[model samples]
Every structure is written in structure tokens, then in C-alpha cells.
Target chain A: GDKVKQSPSALSLQEGTNSALRCNFSIAATTVQWFLQNPRGSLMNLFYLVPGTKENGRLKSAFDSKESYSTLHIRDAQLEDSGTYFCAAEAPGGSAKLIFGEGTKLTVSS
Target chain B: EAAVTQSPRNKVTVTGGNVTLSCRQTNSHNYMYWYRQDTGHGLRLIHYSYGAGNLQIGDVPDGYKATRTTQEDFFLLLELASPSQTSLYFCASSDRDTQYFGPGTRLLVL
Candidate 1:
């Protein structure tokens, strides 16, 4: 079985639009992290959460450990937001390992 | 800014050949990790180290060996490469829950 699963494998949004990406965890995740892999193939860390919500600029993320899920919301999407978004979860205990989802490929066009 | 760098950004090897991927982080973080990303499996952890000379196996550690010679350097070794081992490898350093990633190394085994 898949430990972490992401929905809406691919998405397309118009400039200034908004969309959301979701991740479901089958493992007992203690924390979650979000990242964006840009077109140039560089991974940029977005957020690291421990069961709550955090907003930065036009991006907001929420993680619910009890419910075992996480969501990343993009507001006022721009051309620079076009990339693959990935969510990773760290299981309970002292493990630093992160189980990742396949990712959501996003395209924001003008 | 926390900088994590991986050397030999791209590599090509034949079956039974040897390969090594190197990573260095300047943030002085205590944790470092190695992961492989495939189309369907996303990013699967291969190995991690909490500090110098400490190695911990992840979910997909078979056929891969890692060494952390210092607080800043971590290396992943493939003694006998195979076609199935071809993928994009990432190195990351962490400060608690937040992890910063490297540019990644693309390996191809023929």
C-alpha cells in the first residue's frame, strides 16, 4: 500500500487563479513538509509543519496529524508557480526519514 | 541561506559499474539524507545520517550504501550499478523538522 498519496496528479490554472493540492497519509505522520521543484530542476522548500496551518505570501499549508492528511493552497497563482509540488511526511518516533508522494504538476498560464 | 550542493550533477554508468554521489551542506545541520525519485514512486529515502559516521537505512536502502565522513559531507555509493537504479538522487540537510535540499543528481545505468 502507498504510504503517502497525492490527489489531482496534474493541474492547470490561469494567472491570478487559485487552487489547492492535497496529500493523504497512511502512515502515522508526526510532521509534514511541502516543496516545489521548479522547471530548472531545483527543489525549493515551502513549509515544514507540525499539525497546524501556516501561510507565507500567497501559499498556505495545513497538516493534521490526527486526521493524517495535509493540504497546500496556492492563491493568486503566477507563472513562477508552475512546477511540481511535493509533500513529504515524517513518521512518529525519532526518525528523520521522509516518505513522499508522487507530486502534483502545476501549470499556471497567462 | 542554507546551501546543500551535490557534485557530478549528471552521471552515466553501465551494469556492474561503480558510482558515487556526493553531497555537502554549509548550514552545519546535524542531519543529512539521500533519496531517489522515480516517475511513479516519487522520492524514496535511501539513507540518512544524524551526524558524522552515523548511517541509517531508509525504506529503499538495498543496493545503496552511504557514508558520512564529516558533519558537512555525505556520500552515496553504488558498488554494482543496475538499470533499475537509474533515477534522480537528492541530498538534503535538516535543522529539526525543516529540511533544505540540493539540486539533485541524475543517474543513468545502461
Candidate 2:
């Protein structure tokens, strides 16, 4: 079984549309971080949450430690946003080590 | 912003060869990590260190060795490479909260 399981393994979005990706953690996660791996093979940090919600531009992310889940919401998507989104969770009593989910492949088309 | 860089962005080697991938972070982060990404498995941790001269085994550390020589530099070594080790490798640096990833190194073992 996976410690961090991501939902909607694949997603397609039209330009200017919105979508959400989710991750469920079997481990008791204390924090969550979201990353977008672009076509050029560069991973960019989107948000880092600690049991709350964060909004940056058209992207928002929420982490609920009590429920052991996290969600990333994207609004007004663009073609440049097409990439693989990964969610990583940090468990309690660890030294900043993270367990990653399988990730959600997102394709934003025009 | 944290700046993490990896050398030899692309590499090709024969089986049973020796290879070393290097990573350096400009920011003074305390934690550094190494990960591999494949087609089916999104990403798996190989090794990590909280500081210089400290190493921690990760989920998939069978064929990997990592070392944190300094606060700014970390390296992943493959003493005997295998075809199964062909994958994209990433290095990350964190400050016990948000993590920043490098551009990644692509290795192909023949």
C-alpha cells in the first residue's frame, strides 16, 4: 500500500478552466508540499501548506492534517500549465523527509 | 528563493559502470534529498541528509549511495550501475518546511 496516494491520476483541462487534484495519506502527515514538473524536466514548487489553505495567483492548496488529505486547485488554467503535478507529505517525528504520491498528469489544452 | 543545481543534466553509461551525480544548493538549507522518477513509479526517495556527514536511507536505496559533504553540496553515487537504474534523478534542498528541487539529471544505462 502507498503511504501517499494521489487521485485523478490523469486530468485534462481547457484553457481558462479549473480543476482540482487530491492526495490521501495513510501516514499521519504534518505538512504538505505541491510541485509541478514541467516538460523540460524541472520541478517547480507551487505551495507549501501546514494544515491550512494557501492561495497564490490562480492556484490554491489546502492541507488537512486531521483528515490526512490534501488538495490543489488550479483556476484559469493555461497550456503552459500542462505537466505532472506531485504532492509530497511530511510525517510526524521526521527530519523533513517527504513521501511523494504517484502524481497527477495534467494536460491543459487550448 | 532557493537555488538548487545538478551537474551533467544528461548521462549515458554502460552496465556495471561507475557514475556520480552532483547537486548543490545556494541557499543555506539544512536538509537535502535524492530521488528517482520512473514511468510507473512517480518518484521514490533514494537518500537524504540533515547536515554534513549525516546520511539517511530512503525508501529505494538498494542501488544508491549519497553523501552530504558540506552544507551546500550533496552527491549521489552509483558504484555499479544497472539497466534497471536508468531513470531521472532529482536533488532537493529544504529548510524543514518548503523544499526546492533541482533541474534533474537523466541517466541511461545501457
Candidate 3:
């Protein structure tokens, strides 16, 4: 069984549209983080949360530790947003190491 | 700004060869981790270190070895490489709740 699972392994969105990504954790996660891996293979951190919500520009993320789930919402998709999105979770009893999901490939077209 | 860099961005080797991937972090973080990413399978932890000279086995450690020579450098070694070991390798460093990733190393075993 996977500790963290991401939904919609792949997604396509038209520019200016809105979309959301979800991550479900089988372990008792204490914290969660979201990242976007660009085509060049560099991963950029999007959000780090602890059972709460955070918003930056057009992206919003929420983590529910009790439910062991997290969500990333994107608004006004742009071409630059086309990349692979990954969600990682940190279990309660473990060191700050993370368990990552397979990732969702997102493509935004005009 | 925190930065983690991986050397030999792309590598190609024949079966049963030896390969080494290097990672360096300028963030002065205490925890470093090595992970591999494969399509349809999320990132799997290969090894990690809490500090210099401290190595710990991760979820997938068979056929792989890791060394933390210094506080800022961590290296992953693949001995007797096989095609199954061909994947994108990423190095990460964490300070508290946020984990920063380096540009991945793409390895191909023929």
C-alpha cells in the first residue's frame, strides 16, 4: 500500500481555467508539502502546510492531518504552469523525511 | 536563498557498471535524502543521512549505497548497475517542515 497517493495522474487545462489536485495519505501524516517540477527537471516548492491552508498568487493549498489528505488549487492556468506536480507528506513519528506521490503531469494550453 | 545542486545531470552506463551521483546543498540543513522517481510510481526513498557520516537505509536500499562525506555533500553509489536502476534521481535537504529538492539526475543503464 502506498503511503501517499495522488489523483488524476495526468491533467490538461485550457488557459485561464481553474483546476485542483489532490493527495491522499495512508500514513498518519503530520505535515504536507506541494511542489511543481518544471520540464527542465527542477522542482520548485509551492506550499508547506500543517493542517491548514495557504495561498500564494493563483495557487492555494490545504492539508488536513486528521483526514490525511491535501489539495492544491490552481487558478488562471498559464503555459508556464505546465509541469509535473508532486505532493509529499511527513508522517507523525518519523523524522522530517517525506513520502512523495507519483506526481500528476499537468499541461496548460492556450 | 537555499540551493541544492546535483552533478552529472545526465548519465549513461552499461549494465554491471559503476555510477555515482553527487549532491551538495548550501542551505546548511541537517537532513539530506536521496530518492528515485519512476513513471507511475511516486518518488521512493533510497537513503538518507541526518548529519555528516551518518547513513540510514530507506525504503529501497538494495543494490545502492550512500555516503555523507560532509555536512554539505551526499553521494549515492550504484554498484553493478542494472536496467531496473535506470531512473531519475533527486536529492533533497530539509530544515524544518519544508524540503528543498535539487535538479534531478537522469541515469540510463543499457
Best-matching candidate per DockQ: 1
Alpha carbon lDDT of each predicted model = 0.94, 0.93, 0.92
lDDT of 3 at A7: 88
**Tens digit of lDDT per residue, candidate 2, span B1-110?**
99999988999999999999999999999999999999878888899999999999988999889899999999999999999999999999998888999999999999
In the range B18-61, model 1's lDDT, one tens digit per residue, is: 99999999999999999998888888899999999999998899
Candidate maximizing lDDT:
1
lDDT of 3 by residue, B13-37 (tens): 9999999999999989989999998
Candidate 1 ranges with C-alpha deviation above 4 Å: none
- Candidate 1 per-residue lDDT, tens place, A1-110, comes to 47999988999999999999999999999999999999898888999999999999999999998899999999999999999999999987868788899999999999
Give a tens-digit lDDT track for model 2, residues A1-110: 49999989999999999999999999999889999999888899999999899999999999999999999999999999999999998878876889899899999998
Q: Lowest summed lDDT over 10 consecutive residues: which window, candidate 3 chain A?
A: A90-99
How does model 2 score on DockQ?
Answer: 0.84
Q: Please give, for every candidate in the order listed, the TM-score of chain B alone compared with the true chain B.
A: 0.98, 0.99, 0.98
Between candidates 1 and 2, which one is better according to DockQ?
1
Pairwise TM-score winner, candidates 2 and 3: 2
